[model samples]
Target: MTQTPRIDVVGGAYEEWCLRPAWHEVFGSAGRAASAIAAMAGPSKVTLHCYADARTAQVLEARCALEGTRLVAVAVPATCSFRYTHALQRPEVEVPQSTYASVVVRAETVLRFGMLEGDAVVHGKRVVYDPQGRLTPEPFGANGSSADELFIVLNEREALAITGLAEGATALKLAEATRALHKATGVIVKRGPLGALVLDGDDWTEVPAFETETVWKIGSGDVFAAHFALNWAAHGHSATDSAYRASLATAVYCDGRGFPEQSTLDVFPAMPIRASARWMAGRQPRIYLASPIFTLGQLWLVEQVRENLRMFGLEVFSPFHDVGYGSADDVVQLDLEGIHNSDLVYAVADGMDSGTIYEVGYARAQGKPVVVYCENESSEDLKMLEGSSCVLCKDYVSSIYRALWTAMAL
Candidate 1:
């Protein structure tokens, strides 16, 4: 464990094709994987096994050229699917192949054999056996895929996705189920923005998330996984300490400023542990102003609403102000991002804009508290909006206050 382990990471790598109303290219999971490994403290060699087209290969090659770690990129032509992210549009993703061709490379020869031995191996998808013929099928299940030492890290939603379990499943239940099935040494369930739950043997520990205003939530999970793996693999740290350090590093990544450095590990004493949303009431909550601002009158009202929220000591993300009638894709992206980061959504339904209606539904779907302020009370007959469990208000000023109060209570 003292020496840097030559890690073999098997995962998907593809180009993220997007049109923010204009074409823009970005690296998808492959770039994230490389970045995560480079963020580790020590120098290491990383062999990334992923499928890519020619364009994806060039992009990944240029990116890894400057990375601190020794990079061995093995890319082959494989079926790829396009993933798109735009505002107002539901993310579109084409179905990709379930599996890709895997190879083992040693010395100067690429081994066509199925197995390659390593000190440790990371498998993103389900695998039948490790290089040493160790059974390591993911989630192990009731089937026999035992490992000498196994750690299963998954968030609540991930647990549901993998097992097809219901949303109300407790972290302890998921952990215990996985352990009973797989006989894992430990299972860690991450609670978004709250903290993480670690179950090692019979001892359970909760590590509070480091206090940091989230600027970007995109790659926070990747950062956490990278830190945990590096700490556990290279430093031989305990499951508890590894999860704690991973949480700290993830806090830095969420800031959207830069990668977590070695010094970030030492900065915890000055920071506070994150509290629940209810405890965050004293702070100014960010509000996403969702409404149709097409006409001059609509724009004026939007501005007035924004000013009122600002005067009430709340941060506002107004699509009219932030994203004008620019790229259709960009507008959708900005508003969705704003909604994701906002504490609550204040949707002014004066004209009943379709986009606003969609935003209200979207916000509610994400479990964000939504306050629908309508000038007319006649529109309340719509059962869908009524059954949405949102707070309906007719008065403007009272609606703002009620929404703010509701957000703080949550």
Candidate 2:
């Protein structure tokens, strides 16, 4: 294994050294097929469509030229169904909240090359890279030419220490591999149930065949790949010894399951969960509990709102019946007043009540969070809150707490 062969790694260059290979080796069959995806790799542009005979539809015209792939927007239903709740209103001609939807699509041929955490094996070549802060493509050349390669340094000390954070491989496992293959020449192949293989240059030196006790495979390939890279790159290890070492490492990853990590642990952790409410402990939340002041449900919920906010130490504003319903002659002015008061609006859209619907519209018009709480599980009213910063509540108790937290953080 003199000069390493040139290979190109594709897919999102995510994780340390694209440890995905080690992940597959350790996790086997599971990691083999599923591809990794990230929203950070954004679409080229955004487009907005607000239907109104094209002239008055500012939503469409405003973004058509400016935002061409990822479109963030407010959707309005063709009409607001008044039957959904008490006094609910969705005028056939008026702007509906459901009419907005977000669509983000990558251009047909876009490739995102994140800083190389490690090398990627496309064919049977060893590709080197230098890490560059930039996230786009660059030409591959010698050390000085390659962008600062985030790709794993086959001979570097950190290789073994850098197992996937979420992947089950502990520092011990990584250390063991790193120490043994320090100056050796080999390729580690993480085989699913098949165990691992150590290949020197192109030849197999050992097969740490996995146990026959288990039935699943995952991350096994990743271990195999890492071992292979190390062994192949090690100074003096023969092609034969490299393969044997890779196989041995794969065996440990199998852990008698014959498959791999008992838990479906992957090279990468699952995506992080986003909170329903934007409220946080330090910052205050601008909340809009746009509900009827007269309804018992709305009133009962409002009292809890203050209590929940106290848990996180947050302040919120709710425009209840204070608008003085029949007393107000100008509905538009009354609605705008609520939006102008707060930074965000949380609508109680249960029953799709007209008053609640009006508040949601006002929130949208003001570009504020229109968080909604829906008491009934199955109601068209739920449709009214989709995509907006609104949370549709199914269970009042838990959702109430959740709403407060989410709103304040926003």
Candidate 3:
């Protein structure tokens, strides 16, 4: 019998809460990655190294035991926790703070790196990571000195921080910049719905994201990193091929809000794999926000959608924010100009607002991609949109992701 490979995951484990979709889950980056690794490890061995409070440690211990993985959790005063109003919104610190001691675990073959804390600017307010959130002085080879391969998975923000690259850097640029740092053998930059960029040696590869009916954004990166490490380090696959498999795993996690089992991955539907030169060029699509803003609820929804789009580094033209309330002639011409200038239209069609509907139709006529978010609208009312090839989404998170993916394809 072949000796089983052992993978070590080093990162944070905390509590997560979402208000809009009403979700409560424990495990930050480390725990989530370990769960994903265990789900597909088969005969391989997986271990999680993290610092957590008593409650978090208990939860993680039980979860690891159930998944047939080993957990090496250091007891901390408290576990970091966050609460989010929406899946796309920045989370607020729910639990006070925790001090993490350095954890040293040797990986037999693969090691994955993730962050314990991160900084974010939410609604113009900057929320910095707590000083005590550091798990070690450096993560590169500290936790997996015995491993032959190391992979670092990060979002745009983390990559920027690591490489000291300025904001607005393209995925390829970020990957190349980080390559000089030499933190890992392979660096995978997760770009959410826009997919990921994998950097191995001097070459960069763009991995396309798969489509899913529902998207639960939380912990998706952990799933991607875990799967990528499994395919690349454990199975000896190429970096680009591993990243593609990771993208599929991410889609499964987002759609079901759970880690996919090995059997599910084996029978997963065949997906197209192609390089997108447009995305590689960093040509971000301009988006036109078409929605009714007369009522307070409608205005709130519009703001949420616009903010989420902007969060992804997208340029959005909102009539309410840009044009404001004005005479019909002035507003109509300006909105039309915005649509004409945009590459895609993201319309809120919950109430089938007339102006929004018109904008959608006009955008389609202008050969622009349109993603419509329709929750309560009847199918009869959306017949024209459906017939015209508008991408319709019924949920908030999925709608935002669909809009981003659709715009990226253009």
Candidate 4:
């Protein structure tokens, strides 16, 4: 009988404060996420290597026991951040002062290289890479042990920072670069809402996200890394199979469940695997639809515009369609959030609603590309926007194409 692989999870442990209009809560980091993975792996032992303050260490110790996990906690100052977001709003995170990630990365090196031992180690920190975009294995001691599989799972932002790659760079390039620099058996790049990309040697696969009306997404990425490590390292499954299982596990967690059990496997369907879009020149662009929809007819028109843009493989964020006409403050806050998250702002300026005009200005102030659609207004009509290099379109169909094109440039 094959021995079950003992897993070590190396990462940051921080306190997250999530605030929305309706809810607010605090959560754990590697401890919570790794626990969920440990639960999924049944009897296999998972050792969490992370840093925390005294109080946080105590809390993590309890959480680990709740999920039958072991802790390799390092006592340090706990890192905390306040994230403000709504169901439809992108988060605005504020970090007061936290060297938590940097400190934890240093601690992770000591834990992995100097102390704890495991059959497989999963690393989850972008700080492991230096300014040169190379994984400095010398510091972490990534020895090529034939019996051990080292896996690294990083979100898109983290991957970009570590590899010194810009946004829209091919995921394959990120993965290949990391693999070449580190002694990683494989690298999994998490794309948040879209999906995850699995890279092993020359082969790469995209694991589609299991869509759900997510209640909380604070630790979904960590949960994904844990499950992938379990499947790929412990169970000896292929990278593609591991990523598929991890996606299902993530869906279960997003659906408000703590973790998944082997008996309930049928509840989560196996997500499809496809060729990664990382190499594609233009993956779908995220567009912020800045328009007025005070009336039902206007809302319908915005919906039509959204569908039209979607048909062109663009992700549209029509505040009116997404958040409805909520409170004045709520609408403003969420729309601003959407604009901040978007690649470009596409405004419908037919009537020049004050809110829509403000959104266009806000996008411009933030240095984002702005594309405006007006029925009769020429470039001369919106002189301020034109001076700001905003793209103007007279027709609706043409505006959508122009917005899509402008978004790609952004």
lDDT of 2 by residue, 80-145 (tens): 111111101111212244422222222211111212222221211232121122222222222122
Name the candidate, 1 or 2, with the larger TM-score value.
Answer: 1
- The candidate that wins on lDDT is 3
What's the ranking of the predictions by TM-score, best on top?
3, 1, 4, 2
Q: What is the lDDT of residue 248 in candidate 3?
A: 90
State the local distance difference test value for candidate 3: 0.74
Clashing pairs in 3: none
RMSD of each: 13.2, 23.8, 6.3, 13.0
Cα lDDT of model 3 by residue, 291-358, tens digit: 99999999998889988998766789999999999899879999899999998999999688888999
Evaluate residue 171 in candidate 1 and report its C-alpha lDDT on the 0 to 100 scale.
77
For residue 164, give model 1's deviation from the true position in Å: 4.0
69, model 4: CA deviation in Å? 2.3
Quote the positional error of residue 37 for candidate 1 in Å: 2.5
Q: What is the C-alpha lDDT of each candidate?
A: 0.60, 0.36, 0.74, 0.62
By lDDT, is 1 or 3 better?
Answer: 3
Greater lDDT among 2 and 3 belongs to: 3
Q: Top TM-score: which candidate number?
A: 3
Q: RMSD, model 3, all Cα superposed?
A: 6.3
What's model 3's TM-score? Answer: 0.82
- Residue 127 error, candidate 2, Å: 51
